[model samples]
Target: MLEKLQPNEIVDSIYQINLSHLKEKGIKAVIADLDNTLVPWRSTEIKDTLTAWVKDVKDAGLNLAIVSNNTSSRVHTLSEQLGVIAVSKAVKPRRRAFRNIASQFSLIPSEIAVVGDQLLTDVLGGNRTGMYTILVTPMSNHEFIGTKLIRQIERFFLKRIKNKST
Candidate 1:
């Protein structure tokens, strides 16, 4: 299971991604999961740190977009503040959402990076599509009921992977 990636520690909010590293890797655009990945799930507004980071990422010549399985209102509100387009109700771990987002950026899967906090959704989705996936720890563990349940299963698998590696 560790074969797919060298799992990384959380970047401490979206603001912390090393833009230079990303640029060196030819990552011209970022397609991110908005909820737990960018902010606490359902968070209404962008934080000051994130707001600035968004600009930094853009200024560094990287385009940004949000791919979320949320309502248009929620995604749009956040997208407007972050200066990025958003695809609401993105069915992740499936290629459809990624495909649509990629089209928006005029990018191929290889040139776009997907950032999120979940393993099964973000990591798997990006990996499936051959996009670089960055798994950041969620800002808050308190999430939707369904997510809480999925996270339980995700942790179980993660622990299993760790044990075998040890």
Candidate 2:
């Protein structure tokens, strides 16, 4: 159970992810968490850097999708603006959304990489489905109250994972 929460890789931000490395690993698609992973929570503003990164991913021949636990309107609106696939109200740590995206893309679990800012949701969900998982630091300190609470528990696990690494 604890191993399911472990991320395959940890990066400070999405920008740091290596596109070439993903391709080398046979990752043809990337499913990303919307809030905090791509942008700050509930923020409609899309940064220029993010826009460029999306283009870069596409240019690298990778499919991209945005999955969020937020409302449809919020997720659709942003995903449309970015021109990527979107799945709203995903309820992560559950495998449904991830599996759905994989099916939609006609890709197997190993062909997809899941990237997100939360351990409980992104890492666990991806790992459960046998997809590569990348954990990125939350973009801002501001987030949902429930998420803040989960962060406390996440910290304990992070410490354990780090200690084990040594």
Candidate 3:
């Protein structure tokens, strides 16, 4: 079943997350989303903070990679520059890319966390693959065509979260 996780499980921002804590939890790897999750969906340059974040992940002895639904060019550019593995045009929530990422890294699903801004694609995909999922706020109001539609649906679930929060 798709579990409705709390905000703590989702994390407020990428910087606030503690890799050591995740390591303690036996989470040794990460499969992250690119658009909005890491960048502004179309921003080409990586900020110092993002670069440092990736460095910290590696420094923490964690295997990391980018799994994006975007084309190879974009993911490859970002992944190569950041020194992480990548799978593009991922078609997420389908399990193909998620399974591939785990296999490539020789990581068990339980040992990985998938971080993304969208609940429908990233969160659902990660959960289906039995990985911990982190749903963050989108970097920009603009989203891909399909993602736009999903946001509308996500609001319904978010409303439930809001009600519970109150």
Candidate 4:
């Protein structure tokens, strides 16, 4: 059970992810979390660096999508601005959304990489669907109240995972 929560890779932010490395690993598409992973939690404000990274992902011949548990309006609005596919209200840690994205992209699970800031949601969901998972540090402290609670539990797991790795 705990193994399912483990991320295949951990990075400080999405910007640190190497596109070429992903390509080399045979990843054809990327599914990203919306809040914190892309923009700050609940914020539509996009950073120039993020725009450039998105462009770079496209330039490298990779498809991108945003899957968020946030409202449809919030997710769709930001996805449109970024020109990427969006799946809103995605209850993560479930396989449905991840599987659907794979189907939409016409790619198998192994061909997609799921990137997000949360282990329980993004990482667990991706792993459950057999997709490569990358975990990034949260962009800001601001988050939903429920997420704040989940973070506390996540910290405990993170520590255990770290200790095992060492």
Candidate 5:
């Protein structure tokens, strides 16, 4: 169970992940989380820096999709702004949404990388679907109530995993 919760890589932020590296790894698609992972939770706009990152990934010939648990309106608005496909209200750790994105892109799970800020949602869900999972630190401490609770549980397990690695 714990192994399933672990991500293939953990990065400080999405900015640190290089699209060139992902391309070198043969990753054809990227299924990313919206809130916290891409931007601060509830933020409606994408800044200039993030826009450049998105452009870089696309320029590298990688498909990008936003799979978020946020409301459809929120997700749709942001996705439209970013010009990427999206799956909103995606109950993560569930393969349905992940599968949908993979199918839509016509790519196998192995060719995709699932990037997000949560373990239980992004990491576990991505791992279950056989995709490479990348976890990033949350953009801010200000989050929704449910996320706050999940973070507490995630921290406990993450701590244990760190200790075991040592």
Candidate 6:
């Protein structure tokens, strides 16, 4: 059960992700978390670098979706700016949104990757649906109170994984 929360890849940020490599692996879509993963938890505006990253993903011929547990308005706004689909209030760790991404892209589970900063949400949810999962460090130290608590728990699990691997 705990292992399901483990991510297939860990990176410092979305920029570190190899879009071309993903395409080579036959990845057809990416389901990414908006808050913390793409931007700060409270930020509404998209950064220039992130804009280029979105363009690169699209240029690579992979579909993209921004899925978040945040409000629809927030997600929709960013998704529009990034020119990707948005799934708001996604209640991650559940398979509903994951399945939705697959359905929306007309891709199988193995052909998509879930990207986020949270293990409980992104990794666990993606793993549950048998999708590739990538965990990136949060973009900012600042986070919501609920996310802070989850981060603490995630740190513990991450440390355990690191120690075991070493």
Against the reference, the lDDT scores of all candidates come to 0.80, 0.93, 0.84, 0.93, 0.92, 0.90
Q: Write the per-residue lDDT of candidate 6 for residues 46-136, one digit (tens) a residue.
A: 8899999998888899999988988659789889988899889889988898899899888999999999999989999999999999999
- For residue 79, model 3's alpha carbon misses the true position, in angstroms, by 0.7
Model 4, 25: alpha-carbon shift in Å? 0.8
Error of 3 at 68 (Å): 0.5
Tell me the deviation in Å of residue 125 in model 1. 0.7
TM-score of 3: 0.91
Stretches of candidate 1 exceeding 4 Å from the true structure? 1-12, 160-166
- The better candidate by lDDT, 1 or 3, is 3
> What ranges in model 2 sit over 4 Å off?
none
Identify the runs in model 4 with alpha carbons over 4 angstroms from their true place: none
RMSD of 5: 1.0
Candidate 3, residues 52-121: lDDT per residue as tens digits?
A: 9999999999999999989849789888999999999998877899999899989889999999887777
4-111, model 2: which lDDT tens digit per residue?
Answer: 888989999999999999999999999999989999987889999999999999999999999888875989988999999999989898999999999999999999
List residue ranges in candidate 6 displaced over 4 A.
none
lDDT by residue (tens digit), candidate 4, 5-43? 889899999999998999999999999999999999878
What 10-residue stretch in candidate 3 is worst by lDDT?
1-10
TM-score of structure candidate 1:
0.89
My TM-score estimates for the predictions, one after another, are 0.89, 0.98, 0.91, 0.98, 0.96, 0.96
Cα displacement (angstroms), candidate 3, residue 58, comes to 0.5
